[model samples]
Structure formats: C-alpha cells, structure tokens
Target: MDKTFTYQELQKYNGKDGNPAYVSYKGTVYDVTESDLWKNGRHQNLHDAGDDMSLLIDQAPHGVEVFERELVKEVGKLV
Candidate 1:
C-alpha cells in the first residue's frame, strides 16, 4: 500500500513509546519517537524506524498535499 506523511504529522509521535505506527515485517512496532533523524525537521541520519514511517505515510513535497492528505488513512490522526 502507498503511504506518506508530513513533518507536522510526524512530530506528534514518540519512539517506542508503548505505541507503534506500523507493524513491522518482523511483527514489531516501530516507535517513531525512537528515531533521531526525525528531530527538529531534519533527517540527517537513517534509522530502522524510518521504514515504519514509510508504512504509515509517504513523504513528498508540500505541493503534493493532495496526495499526502490520505497517506495515513486510519493509522494515527487523520490527515
């Protein structure tokens, strides 16, 4: 399934904070808050949890708002 997300939507999460955005291939929940790359709107580094973020939403330029609006769907808050 295709999915996407925005920086704002990404912020409302915490790493492995006893919640998960997506069920991993290994049957694990990736805590968004655990990823350091998501800090301060800058993804300077790659982390394992990033893959989970992809399952929840696909990131695109702001102009792609039309597409991004439905990325998360029922997961987390509705876009």
Candidate 2:
C-alpha cells in the first residue's frame, strides 16, 4: 500500500542532512532525490523539497506532464 504522510511528516524528508528529497503534487508525494534538477533539495533555486508543489506547478513553464514522465518516482500520498 502507498504510504500516507501529513504535511508535518513530509517535512522530515527534506533532502537535507542525509534525508531523502520529496515533493508533493495533487496529494501525491514524489521522490526527487535522483534528479539533478533537485540537487540539495532545491529545484533551480526556485522550489524546495518537502513542499506541496501543487500550487507552484501552475507557475512553472512546464505542465503537470512533467510528473508523469520518468523524471520522478511516485512514493506516497500526502494527507
């Protein structure tokens, strides 16, 4: 079953101090640790890891399809 994480719990995976980098979109959490674009838990110095990216995604140049691509892995769901 997919893991469920609360906003508070999601903060623990901030890709800092050896923790894995995770970001949420539309209630789903994605593992972005493997993406170079998300180096150091930061994306292009614009977005940070462990954040609900749902809102910011709309402002991005790309669309939600980016999440459907192999760029990131679905890890869990956000509550």
Candidate 3:
C-alpha cells in the first residue's frame, strides 16, 4: 500500500544537510533525493523539496516532462 504523509510529516525531507529530499505534486509525494538537480533539496536553486509543487509547475520553464525526464519515484501521498 502507498504510504501517507501529513503536511508536517512531509516537511521533514527538505534535502538540507544531505537529508533525503521529497516533494509533493497533486497529492503524491516523490523522492527527489537521488536527483543531481535536487542537491541540497533545491531544484535549479529556485524550488525546494518537502512541499507541494503542483501549483509551481506552471511557473517552471518546462512542463510535466520534467518528472518523466527525471524519473522521480513516488514515495507516498499527502494526507
């Protein structure tokens, strides 16, 4: 079964200090820790992990293709 996370629980993986990085999109959480672009939990120095990025995608230079391209794996769901 898929794991579930509360907003506060999901906020723990912000990628700082070499911690695992995670981000939520459309209520699904993805493990972005292994991604080079997400070093230190920051994506392109603009976006950070541990939060919902669904609304931020439109502002990104690219589209949903970024997820497929990165092959980011879903880890859980936001409660």
Candidate 4:
C-alpha cells in the first residue's frame, strides 16, 4: 500500500483545533478531530475512537483525524 500521511503532517492535523485529516480504514470514514481525538496524534484503540465506534477499523495504520462538518469545535487548547 502507498503511504498517505507523515509524522509532520499528522502532527499539524491532529493535536490542533483545525482541519482534521481524513483517514480511510476498512472503506469507512471516521469523524476524528481535535475535539474528540488528539489534534496531531495517532491513536489506535477503541478508547480514542469515541465509544469503540468501529467506524474506523482496518489493517491501515491508525486513521488520520479528518475535519468533519458535524464535528465542529472552537480553536482553543486541547481539552
């Protein structure tokens, strides 16, 4: 498989209250953002996945948090 996200890019996307990166896993789109998951960090677990949503399950390296429309939040410190 081709590499999609990088450490630097992932950091910029996660761990920040901005545009969340979209990570395609198991042919499903997850609404990961700084609001719920860490802004620029990679979390591979049922905990960080917002109630084991399973919306992002696959062999792919931890999905990159993407900016979801419904997942809106203020640009501030990481709660």
- Model number with the top TM-score: 2
lDDT of 2: 0.90
Q: Kindly report which residue pairs in candidate 4 clash with one another.
A: 14-39, 14-40, 15-39, 15-40, 16-39, 20-66, 20-67, 21-65, 21-66
Candidate 1's C-alpha runs over 4 A off are: 21-79
Model 3 quality (TM-score): 0.88
Q: What is the C-alpha lDDT profile of model 3 across 1-79, one tens digit per residue?
A: 3799998988899998767899998888889888898889989989889988989999998887666655588788898
**Superposed model 2: Cα runs more than 4 Å off:** none
lDDT on C-alpha atoms for all candidate structures: 0.34, 0.90, 0.86, 0.38
- Lowest lDDT block of 10, candidate 3: 64-73
The numbered model that scores best in lDDT is: 2
lDDT of 1: 0.34
Off by over 4 Å in 3: none
Candidate 2 residue-wise lDDT, 8-75, digit = tens: 99988888899999999999999898888889899989998999999999899999887776768899
Q: 1-79 in candidate 1: lDDT tens per residue?
A: 2243444444434334543333122222233333333453233443333243444334433332322333322333223
lDDT of 4 by residue, 2-78 (tens): 23433343335433344564333332334355344444434543233222223544443544343344574322222
TM-score of 4: 0.27
The parts of candidate 4 lying over 4 Å away from their true place are 1-17, 44-79
